[model samples]
Target: MRSIAKPATQHTITANAKVVDQLPFQDRQAYADARQGFIGTIDPLVITDDSGRVVWDLEQYAFLQDESPTTVNPSLWRISQLHMAHGLFKVTDRIHQIRGFDISNMTVIEGESGYIIVDPLTSVECARAAIELVYDHLGERPIRAIIYTHSHADHFGGVKALIDEDDIHPGGVRVVAPSGFMEHTVSENVYAGNAMYRRAQYMYGQNLSVDPTGMVSTGLGIALSQGQISLIEPTDLISDSGQELVLDGVRIEFQFTPDSEAPAEMHFYIPEMRALCMAENVSHHMHNLYTPRGAQIRDAAAWSRYIDEAMRRYGHKSDVMFICHQWPVWGTDSIRDFLTEQRDLYRYIHDETLRLAAHGHTMVEIAEMIEFPEGLATTWTARGYYGSLNHNAKAVYQRYLGFFDGNPANLHPHPPVESARRYVDFMGGAEVILAKARRSFDDGDYRWVAQVVNHVVFADPDNTSARELQADALEQLGYQAESAPWRNFYLTGAQDLREGVRTDEATLGTSDVLSAMTTDMLFDYLAIRLNGPKASGRNFTVLVHVTDTGETRLAELIHGVLICTPVDGHADADTSVRLDKPTLTGLALGAATLTDAVSAGAVDLSGDDELVYDLFTLFDTFSRSFDIVTP
Candidate 1:
C-alpha cells in the first residue's frame, strides 16, 4: 500500500519518443550481431544454487520482446532486447561464449584437450550453470586454465564455482591474471565493499520490479546474479605488455592495460584463432569513467590508449572480437571502425572535459556543456547506455581537479539535511517550493523539479505532498533515462521516498572474499573497523598469531587509531592471541565473537584476554542499508 509508482507522464513519453527520431533506430546491425552465433539455451533459463534459491531468471526480461513502451527509453529498450538473448553461442570453431548468464560473458576457448575459461560471471550459481551449458553442448573437458582479465568481482568472483585450490597447482588448471589483481580485488571488494554494495542496489535497481516502468537492462547485461560470489588467488601473474602464454596448446599474447577500466586489467589476443578479447575495456556502449555505485574514477585517457593499442596489435589479424559484456564484433573493417569510434568516445570525453575546465568552467558547468561530436554521437557504441555524457564529463573534471569547484562558497558546504532545511527556508518554506515545483513538473522540467523537491523531502521527510511530487519528478526522469543505472537510481530513489527503504533485498555476501584474504589484508580490514571514539582515551596492545599462515601481527590501539604491523614474536604486548587463519577469518566475518572463539578452544589467549576482548568490542559493525533518499 505504501508503493505509489505511476505510469509515464505525457512529458516523459514525448521525450523518449523523440529519441527514436534523433538516433538511428533503423540500424539493425546491433541486432544481427547480438543474435549471431546463437546455440541452444535452457528452456526456462532460470539458474539456482544447491539450496534451490533462484539466482538468475531470464524470464523476467520477457517483457523486453515487445515494441518500446512509452514508459521506457527507446534506445535503452533496443539494447535491453539484445541483452535478453540467453544461451550458449558459438563465436568461432575454436571459441564459444556463454552470454546472458550473468553481467559478464564467459568465453570458452577450445584448447588441445581441455577448455580455457575467461572472465566467469559474478556468482557461483551462474558460473556453474554456464559450465553445465558448455558440458551439455560441447561435451565435458578438463578445465586447463581460467583467465581473469581484470580485478573486478564480475570477472573473477565465480572462480571457486569452476575449480578449487587443488586445480590451481602446477600441471592442473592454471589460474592466470594481470598484475596487482589480488590487491585491487581485495581493496575494491573488501575495504569499501559494504558501502559500494549499498549504493549498487540503487544503481542496479535491485529493489525495483522488472516491468516496462521498472528495470529493463543494466546497459551491460540483464542483471547481476544474486548468489554466492567466490574468489581464488591466481597462480600466474602477467605484468609485461608483450607477455605470452601457451595454455592447452593455444598461444595467447597479452597487452596489460591497468587503470583503464579496472585497476588491474589486460587485453588478450588469441593468435591461433585470430580472435581478440578486449576484456571490459571495449563494450557496445559508453562506459562510466566514474561508476554511480562508487569506486576509483577510471582513467579515460588511459582507456582510449588501450583500445588504440589493441587496434594496432590485432586489428587486421582478427576477424572476430569478443568482449566481456554485450555482443561481439565480426569482420576486420567493422571491428576497426568499432575500435576507432570506441577509442574516440573516451578520448573525446576526457580531452574535451579538461579543455572546458581550463576555460574556467566548473565541474557542473562542464557536465552541462560537453557533448559528443557528430560521428561519435551517431555511433551506436558511443551512446551512453551505461555511462552518460553529463556524469562522465564531471568524472573527468573530478580526476584532474578535486571535488572543490575553486570557489570558497562551494567549499565546506553544509551537509545534506542541514543544507536542505536552509534552502527550503530561503525559498519561502515547503508549501511555496512545492507549488513552484509542481508548475515546473507540468512544464516537463523534471530535472529542475527533482532537484528542488529533493530539498523539501530532506528538510521534512514526513511531508506527503512534497514526497509524492518528488517521487513523480524522479519517476519521469527514470522513464526518459537512456542509461539503465541512471534510470534505476532515479526510480529506486522514488520508491524509497514513497514506500521507505527495503532492507530485505540488500545483497552483499563478502565472506568468500574475506576467506581468500591474506593475513596482512585481514589486519588491514580489522584496523578499518576500529571505532575511534570508543578507543580514544584507552591504549592497549594485542599480538595476533595465525598458526596456519605463520603470520604474527602486533595490533596496537593508540590515540584512537588501530595500527597493525608484522612482528617476529609476541613481545611488548599486554595480551597475545593465537589462532588459525580460518578462526581469524571467522572473527573478521562476524561469524563468531572473540569470547565464543576462546570458549570453543579455537583461540588461545594469554597474558590479558580481557584486553583482547575489549579490543574486539571496539570494532564497529556497519549497517548494510543506510538511509540515502532521506537524512
Candidate 2:
C-alpha cells in the first residue's frame, strides 16, 4: 500500500472542527458507563494465530491514547478512545463480555453446567483469544451452546475457535440461530462475495495505517481481524416471536426480527436476568440501511417496527440492555429512552424520505432536504458515525422508489467512460476542467471540484494534473466527513488515484465456509460466475456425481443461462464426472484445475473431456482489485 500525503488544511475544515468541538462535550455519561464493569485486560494486547501471523493488535491504535487531534473529528475520537478500552468485564453476575477483542463483542453467559456463548467474534484467532481470556480469569468451563443473533459473517464466523464438530451433541451442545440464517449467510458471502470483499478493503480501511489522518474506529469498533473465518450450521432455529427455550436452567425468550439489521436477525430476552439482548438492531451508533460495501438495501420501516416491538415486549421488564457492538444501558429509563430514540431515528428517515418522494422529489433532492429534528440530532446515539443522514435518506427513497427518479433523462444514461469523454469535450477539454476544478478546490468547494475533476480523470486517466486535483478534493472531503466509512472511502479513493489501484490478491472464502455451503448454494454461486455472453448459443448438459455425498446434479446451459437440478442420472449427458465435494469445492475456488484433478485421480471422467473443459471456460474469474474511482 502507498503512503498518502497529509491532508491539506483549509479554513472550511478548521471551521467544521470548531463547530464539532462546541457541540455537547459536557456529556460524560457514555465515558462513565463504558468503564462500569471493568475487570482486566491482557497486558500488551497482541494476539496471533497458530501460524504466528498477527490477527489482531490493539497496539496499532496506541495513538488514540492521546487527545483528539485537529485532523480527527472530536466525537469520533472520543468513541475511538472508548473502544480502546480492551478487556474482560462482567456484565452482571453470570454474563460477561470481552470487548475490543475484535470488531464485535464475544459474550459469555454462565450456564448451570457450562457456558453459552453469544456471537463468537469475527475470526477464529480472535474468538480463541477471547475464550482464553475468560478461562484465565474465570474457570475453564465447557461450552454447552452457542447462539448467533444474525446471519452476518462477523457474528458466527468463529464457531470453530471455541468448539469442534465432535463436541456438538444433539441435546448437549446446541448451536442456535434465527430462521434463514444459513441461507442468508451463504448467499451474502458467496453470490456477491468477490465484489463485497473487494469493497470491504475501503470500507474497513484494511490496508491503511492507524493514525489520526488514516484509519480510525469504524464506529462499531476498530476494524475486522485479518484471520481465518469459519462457520458452523446451527442446531436450533428460532422461527417466530415469543419463541422460548430453556437451556442449562436459563430461561430465554426470542424476538425474531428478520430483515432488520440482517436478512435473518433476532433480539432475545433473558427473563431470569431481566436482560434484553438487542443483537445488532440497536448498536451504539446509527447503522447503515445501505452499507457502501454493497448488499440488498435494508428496510427502514421494518427496522423501526422491530425496535418498537422490542420496546413493547421487553423494555419495561429489562433492567440492562446489552448489544453486540458497544456498552450496555443499565437503568430502566435509560434503556427505554435509548430504544425510543433509535426507533424514532429510523422512522424519521423512513417517513420523511417517502413524504418528500410523494411530493415529486428526486432521491438526491430528498436526501438534501431532510434533516433530523433537534430531539434526535442532539442525542449522541443518533449521530452519523456509522450511517449518515445524507446517504441513508437516499437509501430510504431507493427502498420505495428505485434508482430511477422517474426522469427520462436518467432512464438510460451512458456508461461512465463515454459520458466522461462527452462531458470533457463539452467543457472544452481536460485543461479547462482542471482549471475550473483548481479554482473550486482553492475556494473549498470540494464537492463541486470532485464532480468536475472526476470527468477529467475518466476522460484522460493518464493526466497527472487531473488525478492530483481529484485526490486533493477527495482528501478534503475525507477530512470533513463525520462517518468513519465515508472518510475511509474518500481517502482510499484519493490514495488509489495517486498510486494507481492496488492489485493485492485476496482469497474469496475459507474452506470451512466452502464446506458448509449447501449444494443449492454452491449451484447459485456457480450460476453467478457463468458468463452469459460466452455461453450464448452453446447448449450442453453435464452430470456431476459427488461420491462422498452420494448426490448427483444435472446441469444445462441454454439461452445464456445455466440451470442445475438434482437428479439421479442423465443418460443423454455429454459428459459425466465423478468427484467428491472437497474436490468440487477446490475446482470452484480455482485451487484445482480440471487437468490437475484428472491427472491426480481426484476427478474421474467418463465422457467428453473437451465439453467439460469448454464449460469451465465459460466461467469468469473476478479480480479482487477492480478499479472503482476511475473508469
lDDT tens digits by residue: candidate 2, 59-159: 98999989777667777787788788788988887999999988899889999999999999889999998999999988898999999999987898788
Cα lDDT for residue 394, candidate 2? 91
Clashes of each: 0, 0
Instruction: Please report how far candidate 1 places residue 112 from its true position, in Å.
Output: 1.0
lDDT of each: 0.89, 0.86
- In angstroms, the error of model 1 at 301 is 0.8
Worst 10 residues of 1 by lDDT: 504-513
lDDT, residue 53, model 2: 95
**Judged by lDDT, which candidate is best?**
1
The 10-residue segment with the lowest total lDDT in model 2 = 1-10
lDDT of 1 by residue, 1-631 (tens): 2875688889988998899999998889878888898888888989998999999999988989899999999999998999987889999888999999998899999999999999988999999989999999999998999999999888987887799887766688888899999888877867887788888999999999889888898998889998888888888899988899999999999999999999999999998788999999999999999999999899999999999999998999999999999888888998999999999999999999999888999999999998888898878888888999899999999999989999999889999999999999999999999999989999999999999988999999899899899888899999999999999999998988888887643333336666778888878878888888999999888888889888889988999898888998656999899999988877875666788888899999999878988889998877777888888
